[model samples]
Target chain A: MASYKELPKTAQIRLVSSHEEVYEPCDDSFALVDALLADRTKLLEHRPMLCMEIGCGSGYVITSLALILGQEGSGVNYIATDINPHAVRVTHETLEAHGVSAELIVTDIASGLEKRLAGLVDVMIVNPPYVPTPEDEVGAEGITASWAGGENGRSVIDRILPIADRLLSEKGWLYMVTLTANNPSEICLEMKKKGYASKIVVQRSTEEENLHIIKFWRDFDNEVDEINNQSTFMGSLLSQIPPFSFWRGNNGNDSDKNKC
Target chain B: MRLLTHNMLSSNIRGVVNGFPLRIEAGKVVEKNVEINGDFLKNMFVKIDWKAFVEASQSMGYTELPEEADSSMLDSDEFLNRFHHALLELHLEEGALVCPETGRRFPVSKGIPNMLLHEDEV
Candidate 1:
């Protein structure tokens, strides 16, 4: 049997703080962190200078990323933004509880930071509001802003794609969570036009939902004209992947730093 | 927020040009120790705007940073220490980041800046 020492370091569920108005960490959050964990080796080698999270909903994902990266001597910087003020505060407490820190801002996805962060971010992670809902429901207030994606769950995702493109450096990488309703394939083709090649890092399906964590990076080889011809093929290729992996509830137990 | 954040932030309000450095209104400043990494500091030096960074540190009541700096100065241990302190250690616990062009104030409460714009601003 694998001992506790073999377990990977991530944000402990007990250490993660929460607020009624803030979106609590759920399955989607777990999937995103698991993807990061699976890619931990590449991330360490990536040596990203600045890592950011667009919607740091309970701070679970960002905190997990920091722990996975082992921030002490790595000299990596973290920044997170959320539209809801309560989420930011809750995230702060979560980070504090874990002895990790990040610059948290209450903003509408990267607003007021575009010029300053443009082409500077090396790694950006997002668990966006990909849940489909009424258009008016999008950005309503509080927790609603956390999951209300208008019109086929593309409203917020659409807006963030352009901003992600602008802020990402030439070597930047983006990992985002998407629901099946959000049309992950079309999203990949859209990003392809902007010279980003994407691969699904994690795919999970449960009784009620299908989730995919997609990672995108600048691919100079994918020219604009070439993307037009490949769009249909790319769409089919992405859509055909079977959701074979079921996310195991690995975060069920509360484990502290000294457990090992 | 730290000066490194300040160095990267600008007044992104609509129709505002030349908002490279949002003027700092330091209300309450705090310093926390951060482990110094010379390689990180040296790499960041090329990307940082020295003039704006110096001005930011001065507003935070840290005047040790020189008015002008060059890459060669990064070799000095003293300069690196000051640079590290100014860049990462100092935090604006309670303050406001004023937009240079419109004089719009974005309040920084509990070290978290409220950068969300009103509907009109959007």
Candidate 2:
């Protein structure tokens, strides 16, 4: 007998429509979906009223999100935006195939709707253009927009962070995919400055690259870390610097400080 | 295009600000019956733009929806079914969405409205 209580699954490929110019669901996309699944319990409890996706590609991530949060959260509204018009059409067919739906827009990330949707999104997701390329290639036409990230793959990612911050509600949650080459820790540090707490929800190493799905949310207590950092910066550096063997022999509390 | 999709669409052409509620000139409208799910309809009510919805419905010859969404009608199964029929079942098969500011016509064919702007217009 089938289990009466089964976990929701991502949208099947049969339901995912495609086009030549659109980016299909790949390792990065699946990793993003996995991050969402890992956080599903918190998500359902969050009861997000509005969910938005930037750079939707073939609609895989948004569709997976909607399906994973199915009936219990039918009230959730989904809107997906892509710079590629072809992606918008493919997403339409994909959503229709699964008997689910979202408002599809073709434009730069949430361009026209920025004013209307400002600070209204409860959940936002992105598997951005993170492949290193020339700055000119970052937002190029058609398929190039799918994976062309210029100079450390931060061009598109940098533009998206501010927009995500502007669109996210006070309690909003954001999940984004980043490559190891993109410098994940520095990205986290940058978000820390913006008062967002982040963690690597999913990390996968494939032949091509190391992918990290980072989840960030508003941290009201972020200032606490800042205060602690100010007081402990020198102490932390002493623990990290050379002469560790001598310092350890001299200080009995070396292990205690190193624990951090 | 379903009214649900229509509600969120706005013209993004350069220099044309406030492209919402694009004027819909319906050439053809198709209505097909779909399963009635009360919960979905109830949830969609709050997210929907009542004024744009009412205007678009009236344009497609759907006069069942009231000028304003009534909270009292949510619990009624009959009203839920009606709302579902108007929103999910009705499709704008062929039409032209005229940009409010720029007066550009975006053609809707086979129930898909092309909102793609030209290179310079983007």
Candidate 3:
């Protein structure tokens, strides 16, 4: 069974849709929640925080975070928005059910952001469309807005970047998730061009996909030891494989092969 | 709406060549409790683009999905419950669906879609 956690006082409230139909929260949100909870010391120091969740569908992250924060004695104000009105309504219902309060809006991030929310965001979290291939487009209504990352899976992110820059506080943080398909390195480089330094804070690989969560911070240690260790181990293992084995001309040593 | 629907939607009502990526302008999004149909969901799993599904559902504020979903997990009650929630429950209420191409907006109210275009647009 899935368990719920309370968001800390210094933490920003999460906004997610509880309506299971139109919007279902992804696992990354849980991972993020867990990470934040694990690092409560750091998060709590940033008191009176405000967060904006772009493309908040059913209110999974926002609601969960709000409940968690309320329990943790932190007062968090969250603004969750989506282009779909239904998404916004569903999110509102979810928050109400949990006795958490959040401001929900239905608007296109590509067009612009709500004025009232301007320059008040301490953190901006986004999980934009990042599918890479044309063949990746599947379901109709869901896929249209969900995937279809324009030409290079950067369409939506590109549009959101400017808004994030504008909405974020001078020392605010941007937490976003993107796929390997989006070429995270390139995206991070682009963000640097916008005067922000970005780094991959977390990454996990599955059989079919590579998931990455990037954080753009004003000053953060980019040295990720765990990721580096994992990469090195994987590299060494691959090098030992038959395909990567050093090939010295088949020494006429048939007996040497059998001895091993 | 399914990702497939979004892919095929275009603003080509008449001369609008930018007919791709039809947005969901939901008005009355609802969650209904439906019987779990694992077989159907499992079969359709392959057809689904998991990333798109995750992103779409997450955008609506849901993030309870598994990182890597496999059809084999469909037999488990835990997996089925999540699948059922994601596949059958969410509904769009009222809003305008936009076309990524021509910047066309389709009005949606009371869970119904209004894809009609202007006479000249057609």
Best by DockQ: 1
- Alpha-carbon DockQ of candidate 3: 0.02
Per model, state how many residue pairs clash. 0, 0, 60
Residues B17-112 of candidate 1: C-alpha lDDT, one tens digit per residue: 887798899999999987888888988898899899999999999999989899999989999999999989999999999998889999999999
- Candidate 1 residue lDDT tens string, A1-260: 46953678899999999998898888889999999999999998998888999999899999999988755257888999999999999999999998888988899999888877899888999999876666887888888788878776789999999999999988999999987778788888889878888888998875656888999999886565664669565655556654324322223232210011
What TM-score would you give candidate 2 relative to the actual structure? Answer: 0.78
The collision pairs in model 2 are none
Q: What RMSD value applies to candidate 1?
A: 6.2
Model 3 lDDT per residue over A213-243, tens place? 7778653343334344445534543342223
Two-chain DockQ for model 1: 0.74
Write the number of the candidate with greater DockQ, choosing between 2 and 3. Answer: 2
Instruction: Pick the TM-score winner.
Output: 1
Question: Which pairs clash in the backbone of model 1?
Answer: none
What's the true lDDT of residue B89 in model 3? 61
Candidate 3 docking: what grade? Answer: incorrect
TM-score, chain A, per candidate?
0.88, 0.85, 0.68
Query: Which stretches in model 2 have alpha-carbon errors above 4 Å?
Result: A1-8, A71-73, A193-195, A221-260, B28-48, B69-89, B109-113
